[model samples]
Target: MAATELKAQARTGVGKGAARALRREGLIPAVIYGDKKPPLPVSISYNEALKRIYAGGFLSHVITLDVDGEKHKVIPRDYQLDPVKDKPLHVDFLRVGAGARINVQVAVHFVGEDKSPGIKRGGVLNIVHHTLELSCPADAIPEQVTVDLAGLDIGDPIHLDAVQLPTGVQLHGHEIDPTVATIVAPSGMRAEEAEAGAAESAAPAGETKE
Candidate 1:
């Protein structure tokens, strides 16, 4: 993935009042740490940061921070937003080394739903895991994991082992490979409705006692 270029300026003050002032001026306070380097306080344009965040996958995507003409390769570690206004408040970045290994949560994408045999049989697709944490080299981070449901049957399930990981990427730690998605029969409520309708239609007509 291409690096998203962001321009930021060094910040001097550190306090709630200072942060509020920066927000009032359409700026977002942030910090960059990791790689055994001292944490550097900085501020970035709120509009620019919001744009990146809205572009999706901002946390997993590599970003280039330009501070006073110096470029820093970093990834978004955390961020905050105004609870009421839903505006960007602050962001945290982690400086990555050339060969650094990092743990990140990658999103899962399901495909071939229309071609799934289970779906054609009126089975519901139940997702067990929506994301998986993976450990990989900083430069080799995967955008997302794909799970195909082309030939899955009603009782078939997709597990973690079925996902294909990119080179240099692996599941983080000894986490058990759990079910990612599965096909199940339709809801019991629908079955009950059908049974009730059949019983009412088969009932004998009431006779008039005149």
Candidate 2:
């Protein structure tokens, strides 16, 4: 994962008016909290922040925030967007400590679909969960998890336990392992059934009419 560097200034004012004023000045209002520290209000360049956010995977990527010359390692935790224009309004950053384990949702990527027996047999792939919540070391967070569909057959369900996490990473909670995906009969099967029913209904009916 590439680290993105962002520059910000510490803000003294708070609340709606201050936020609006900051936005009017082409800045974004933000806050950094966590690691037992006080919540720090800050402001950053709107264009720069949007560029990083649009760069993709901003939430999962570790960011290096330069707040008034002091560097902080953080990750974007939450953000609010304008409902009408869909522009970013506020952002919340979570400070990460060295070796600290943080819970984050990691995107799951499916691979080896061409090798799956189910797919070869015209089985449809049904995804149950697109992401998995994981607890990982701050410095070792994985960008995404890969789930292989090789050797999978129709009616085979992939479970959470089948995924392999990197070293220093683990499932976030003790909840029961859930199904990630499964293969089932394709939609064409339903159409085929309907066609079969229609064929049976049409057969030999003409003789009775005569």
Candidate 3:
């Protein structure tokens, strides 16, 4: 629940040219908007931004961004990346109030995987949803949703309801409970099953006296 402290420079100009100029200076333009307040333009280091973005759960992590002296508590709302080079172009942050609730996508982390019976039997663990969208308190958004895989069998399915979330976090996949993950038979197991089925089908219908 602790917020990360990040220092950023307040931007004076706002335009394509100004953004391009900041990029050339190793800074990426960003905006802080939301919570019924005016937008504040700022810029952060490109390398720092890229490092944090690739570090995992960038959007879900709360940040106490210091813009030239003023500080704002915010969460990343969206970002733009260069398609070709895959570099960060811009980032937008939503101002977070003490009691504000924000919808965020949280990464899924499975524990007890090594202890799963299915995994030990050479079954493949197929993940259906790597990240789950959740409505959580702005200051209490979970970094990741953990699912327990203990004692799971090859044919066992992991439903969304099985996932354990934080205290105040809310999940809205109500109409149809979705499967988060499942353990499936490996290719070798699948092939053996197929061959066994074929052999049974190929058995002669006519009885032969021995």
Candidate 4:
């Protein structure tokens, strides 16, 4: 994880009104806490926070928060966004150590053609799952995990166990999860084919039907 450098200022105010006033001034109220340190209240600029989180991995990205003259190595653990205005409300920073084991949701990327034999024979590909939970050392966590679907064919559904992960990373999904991505025959197309076959069979033996 790399650290994003942003300036922070110590906050002496508390309560909703104070926070609102801070936001009105283009600042985001935040707090930093960890097992070894007491919670420290701070604030940052709205533009900097948005730039850090807009990429979607800010929670796992380590940042060197420059609060006044002291620098803290922290990660964005949580934050709330304004429903209508889409602005940052409150932010929570967590101090992280290099060797710490952390649980996080990683994006899953499916690559290649639908591998099922059914798909090769014209079955539609249906993906029923997306993100997967994983546990790994904070430093070894990957931005995303890729699943190879080039070999998947119709009637063949990839399972959690089949997914590959980086060394020391473990998936939290169970074998019982119905994470189905199948190569299924299109219902309308199948129905039309069946009807055409019936019409051909019903015509006179020597008669040709277009």
As for TM-score, the candidate ahead, 2 or 4, is 2
Candidate 4 residue lDDT tens string, 133-210: 778787777778777777665567777767767899886655454463666677977899899999999998886788
| lDDT tens digits by residue: candidate 1, 87-193 | 89999999998889888988999999999998898889899878888888888888899999999988898988988888888888566788888998788746887
Candidate 4: worst-modelled 10 consecutive residues by lDDT: 173-182
At residue 35, candidate 4 shows an lDDT of 51
Best by TM-score: 3
TM-score: model 1 vs. ground truth: 0.87
| Per-candidate alpha-carbon RMSD to the true structure | 6.3, 4.8, 2.3, 5.3
- How far residue 88's Cα lies from its native spot in candidate 2, in Å, is 0.5
- What is the lDDT of every predicted structure here? 0.89, 0.88, 0.90, 0.79
Better of 3 and 4 by lDDT: 3
lDDT tens readout by residue for model 2, 78-139? 88878998678889999988877888888999999999999998998999988888888878
Task: Give the TM-score of each candidate.
Answer: 0.87, 0.87, 0.91, 0.79
Q: Report lDDT (Cα) of residue 77, candidate 2.
A: 93
Enumerate residue pairs that collide in model 1. Answer: none
